[model samples]
Target: MLFRLALAMGRTLQELRATLTYAEFQEWCLYYQIEPWGEDRADLRAGIVASTIANYAGKLRAEGSDPALPADFMPYLERPEPADPSDDRHLTDDELAAWADAAIFGIPPE
Candidate 1:
């Protein structure tokens, strides 16, 4: 999802000039993959999403933007743990979408 968000940023800047909806963003990911296969694997897909979050957060810190969230947030975002039946709750899709919005648009989640 985070990768999709970052791709959406690129799409906004280089092509679409408009934000893509979630399904559109998913399609973009599948199309852009080198092999363009096995996107159905939830684990691999989650890893992709988490890495994109890390990349975006790193970019922000490298550029010295106001760090909207905490420094440790990315680690949690990138962790590979299964969200199901865990004591540590994971962010929901809507929450992640808001985070992506913040990364892309420089606004805090409401």
Candidate 2:
């Protein structure tokens, strides 16, 4: 059932990005062999949306640098308060689009 449920879920960055927290995102990333960030802080500073996590994942894929998010992203992910943490960390509507401009699509950060 669990496997089926997981299978039922769409296999795309957009799909997985819908329901993820910082902790969950980190765990998922580890499973996919994408480190994108520290385990504890993976999603900690990322946004709770597909675009944010997906952006970083996209960047990693493009860089051909698996096992880690852009080591550069942690700062944004850890931005100070009133900052929507995710928004502060990931910084949507900016370089992310450029970072994720991959040639081909892949599964979510896992």
Candidate 3:
């Protein structure tokens, strides 16, 4: 979502970091299938985070910059962050394993 945030909101990485709350930032990382910090995060939160990141990354790569994106997407659109459409998402086995470990019953090493 960093790239998307940069495209739509025109914010730098640092700016984007500052914009998102603790939870939002974590969610962003999780959305990308990147390793989240700890076991503290709930399964649902991690899933949402992973999805949001994945979706945003896909959007940025596929669509490039958003011409219609406002200068400050957060202000214009209460929550500029996109939803994670994981229904049809293709996650790698390693990724699925981590999510499963954290989300599902058994835990797997990230």
Candidate 4:
């Protein structure tokens, strides 16, 4: 899911994972109307919203008006520094794998 989002947003996976805070990532997903967990028919809803946006853009272009995107359409390029710089340490491989499992599979970290 993150891979697909990265492609759609023209951002690198590392950027998504390391740069954005969890809250920012959630906001980005909400902007795209994609539910990261694929729950509650969210995928279908996102598709409908995307189709609607595309059709609207096409209509605008047909009328000789270029549609402008919202100013806050994209996620922030950088997150603010943590209060404690030491809190910015990189995750270990095992920790990363655990987080991936939790995010992708809904398996709570042990």
Winning candidate number (lDDT): 4
- Tens digits of per-residue lDDT, candidate 3, 10-43, equal 6787887777787885566565455433323344
TM-score for predicted model 3 compared with the true structure: 0.23
Best by TM-score: 4
> The CA-based lDDT of model 1 is what?
0.54
**lDDT, candidates in the order shown:** 0.54, 0.44, 0.54, 0.60
Q: Residue 13 in model 3: shift from native, Å?
A: 1.4
Question: Candidate 2 on 1-42: residue-level lDDT in tens?
Answer: 122224445455555556656687555545544433233345
Off by over 4 Å in 1: 1-86
Tens digit of lDDT per residue, candidate 1, span 1-110? 44444544554443542555668766765664533333233445666666667767677465755433333333333434445675676789999999876644335688
Q: Which rank order by TM-score, best down to worst?
A: 4, 1, 3, 2
Better of 3 and 4 by lDDT: 4
Clashes of each: 0, 10, 5, 0
TM-score of each candidate structure, all chains considered together? 0.24, 0.19, 0.23, 0.28
lDDT of 4 by residue, 1-110 (tens): 57666877688999878887888867775654444433323544555666568767677466765553432132321233547766777889999998777655445678
* Residue pairs with backbone atoms closer than 3 Å in model 1 (clashes): none
Query: Native-vs-model 2 lDDT?
Result: 0.44
RMSD, each candidate, Å? 14.1, 17.0, 16.9, 17.3
Model 3, global lDDT: 0.54
Candidate 2: residue 83 lDDT (0-100): 52
